[model samples]
Target: MNNNNISIQDRSKLFAVRAIKAYTELNKRHFDDAGKVLAKQFLRASTSIGANLAEGEFAQSKADFISKYSIALKEASETRYWIDIMIRSEIISENKFSSMIDEINIIIRILISTIKKLKDK
Candidate 1:
């Protein structure tokens, strides 16, 4: 789909997919037991971002939509924190986590803008 046509849901879904891939890669790297724990936490937070966005799409009211979007934004922030931990703990490389961080930031921006528009309506 064209960039203009792609919805926030689509982008969030893509972000979740990327997160899963990263999780798999982390396992392959043979991260210590602690790394495994962090990986699971990261996976949950990352995937939740998209799940919340999708749920918001069917919200019964504008207020519900805004609430869901806000949750998704919070989840996105949590995902970023996990990425940073992974890099600092040496479970993942700086270069790898940097790209993931960039993608998460894009999702964060979209979620913020979407929430603002909904509130203004």
Candidate 2:
């Protein structure tokens, strides 16, 4: 799918997939036990981003939609943090996490923009 035209739901789902792959790689003993813990946290936050976005799609009201999007933004932010920690700890290389980080940043921006638009309306 074209990145420019992709919906937030699709984009977040794609992000989740990437995060899962990262989790898989990290589980392969990329670091110490602490790395696994961080990986699990990272996976949870990353996947939640999409889950919340999907929930927003079926929102019962404008406030519900905004709420879901806000949750997604928070998840995206948490994902970004986990990935950065991984990078800093050398569990995941900077090169490896760059795209993943970039993707989360984009998702966060989109979620923030969407939520703001809904609130403004």
Candidate 3:
């Protein structure tokens, strides 16, 4: 999908897919069990960003939407944390981490802009 027209839900979904792909690549590289454990955490947090945003779309109230979106933003932040941990611990290569982080940052900016717009409304 075109980046300009992509919804937050779509962006977050892409993030999840990217996270899964990274995890699979790491597994193929024979990451240690500890690294695998971190990958699992990364996967959960990354996927949660989309899940929460999707759920929030049908929220019964504006307040509810804000709550869900807030949660999604938190998940995005958590995903970033996991990515940083992976890089610092040398579980994932710097190049891989940089790419992954760049994608997540896009999602983060989208979420922040969405939340700000919602709050303003």
- The TM-score values for the models, in the order shown, are 0.90, 0.94, 0.91
Give lDDT tens digits, candidate 3, residues 7-77.
77877887788788887887787767888889899999999999998899799999999999999999999
lDDT of 2: 0.87
| Candidate no. 3 TM-score | 0.91
lDDT scores of the candidates, listed in order:
0.87, 0.87, 0.86
The lowest-lDDT stretch of 10 consecutive residues in candidate 3 is: 1-10
lDDT of each residue in 1-121, candidate 2, tens digit only: 2387899899988888988887887787756779888999999999998898889889999999899899999999999999888888888899978777777888888888888888999
Q: Provide the clash count, candidate 2.
A: 0
Clashing pairs in 2: none
Model 1 Cα lDDT, one tens digit per residue, 28-99: 877678989999999999999999988988999989889999999999999999888888987888886777
The TM-score leader among the candidates is 2
* Collision count of model 3: 0
Q: After superposition, how far is residue 96 of candidate 1 from its true place, in Å?
A: 1.5
